[model samples]
Target: MFKNEELEINLGPQHPSTHGVLRVKLRLDGETIVKCTPIVGYLHRGVEKICENKTFFQGQVWTDRMDYVAAVSNNLGWAESVEKLFGIHVPRRAHYVRTMMTELNRISSHLLWLGTHALDIGAMTVFLYAFREREQILDCFESFCGARLTTTAFRIGGLREDIPPGFIKQVQAFQDRFLDCIDEYETLLTENRIWKRRTIGIAPINADECIAFGVTGPVLRAAGVKYDVRKAFPYAAYAEMNFEIPTRTEADTYARYLVRLEEFRQSHHIIQQCIDGLPEGNVMAKIPKVLKSEVNEIYHPIEAPKGELGYYLVGEKGGQNPYRFHVRGPSFVNLQALPQMTEGRLLADVIAAIGTLDVVLGEVDR
Candidate 1:
């Protein structure tokens, strides 16, 4: 009689496909995954603890490093949370500009995901094509904030200044061609037989599983949950902007790809709205240089490119720094769904699962 044995192995603490220093311990029965456990904390920087020691005005910089790919989104979350804690009202123009920059960041973050996810699935041309548009968005980031990756773009109450000269024109130039760029990405992969074969029924988790696991972002949306913080909780200028929450019922790798691609179009639409309907007003609000807080706690949530990125803060009376701080990073929470997606599937599908989750380990380990 032949005996079937299970073999266990580590997928990565160093493998490029794991995305960022993530290690998945997998038990395999032949080529199929029997069990999967993701081990994190490799890149821990004590971000929450460190932010508690920094004053509100000084702590926004650390947010830039948490989700380095979507630093502007992180900045928005941090700024809004602190603003909530202090009850500061940001200017209308600042809200509009912040909305535009954040949507651009959404496109940039998604582009990085599309390129790297495609590369993980063996599509090399799509990687290059995705990064081509991503570079232009990064250029926009640099032109606005003077940094591309760790852009601490927003202040506590508002912006430090208005959009730089010709910024509208720069964004419009990208807007004019971005829809076609999304179509270009679709042309290469949407109908490709290999892409459909690799992604179409692989690594599926239905809406119930996603909700039970607290999954959000494209992963949850792919499962047909239309719960976007932008639409549900509405922050920044998102409440005023027009956009759609893209969802798919498949809850598989290919479905997630289609949803994110549609999101690209929605984000492009939001940016155009901001450019056209941007309000004329002061960018910064009248807040004291030194802000002292009352004993208060606030939790603020935003729809980051990944999912619901939330910041929870506690303030002490007359304190310069937060008494306690916690981050509900989408990557960390969404990563919980990995085993649900990967177990009972082929080991090769694990790569597609991780890629589709779109986790940035910086936030996971922060």
Candidate 2:
């Protein structure tokens, strides 16, 4: 007599590759995955609830803790949303500086994703090369803001101060040599036989499914959706920046890799445009010393590293703290597609799927 049985296993709430306290309950028929269910909240910190209780000025700090790797981007969203709430007009120079720093933050976030995602798939050389560039970006962040990782770099209406003296020259020096660095990443992993074998045609999700799942960013772009918040909904200085949204129809792990590499080029282009076209004016905007709001609600979205990071706020009359607050974190939304990407695929491909999504659990569980 012969018999068949499906094995059910938990991938992790603490494994290195799950990328942050994420556990997937997987049912496997031999080595093929029958189903995958991602379990989150092991790292939940009630960030939204905390923000509702704090003054608007103090709430931005908590945004830094969510998606800590892309904290500058988080800062941008929080500050901009608050500005929107109070009808604040940010200075043109401040917008340019914000744009430049946010683009730099995007590059830094992608470099980390490249390094760790590659490392997860056994491409060690690419990991080292990617981190080298990431370190330089972090150094730039440290110079601009006192802290490197959790940088509360922006205020409500504008930046806290003007860009530090010599900042332009420092960024220029990095910009001059950075294209070559991107080429180096390509040489190591773009055509490598092992890298291709691990990534190509693996962990694919179609464009229709991506949209249905509310997935955005490179993952959705790889499916040929061509939707980007920066392009679709202009924010900060993106209205003036000239760049293209990179897209591919393959919708596999390999396609996402290519899309992000192209994004690296575009982000570099935006930074250059900022450095060359930076206007001279006040970096801070004029607003009331104490921010108070009438009954109003707003939802502001920006293109963060992973995807569309949106902040939703409800203001009360003369309220110093938000009446209600919520965050539509990309990681939380994108994680919904995991089961669709992994079910009926080989067990090992689940790792590729999680990595391709490029989620940060801090934002996921926040």
lDDT by residue for model 2 (1-366), tens:
866999999999978998889999999999999989999999999999999999999999999999989999999999999999989999999999999999999999999999999989988888888888888888888889889999999998899989998889988888998899999999999989999999999999999999999999999999999899999999999999999999999999999999999999999999999999999999998878888889999999999999999999999999999999999999999999999998999999988889999999999999
lDDT of each: 0.94, 0.94
- Residue 63 displacement in candidate 1 (angstroms): 0.5
Give the C-alpha miss distance for residue 36 in model 1, angstroms.
Answer: 0.2
lDDT of 1 by residue, 1-366 (tens): 878999999999999999999999999999999999999999999999999999999999999999999999999999999999999999999999999999999999999999999999999999999899999999999999899999999998899778899889999999999999998999999999999999999999999999998999999999999999999998999989888999999989999999999999999999999999999989998899898989999999999999999999999999999999999999999998999889898999999999999999999999
Q: What residue pairs clash in candidate 2, if any at all?
A: none
The segments of candidate 2 whose C-alpha lies over 4 angstroms from its true place after superposition are: none
- Roughly what TM-score does model 2 have, to 2 decimal places? 0.99
Cα lDDT for residue 197, candidate 2: 94
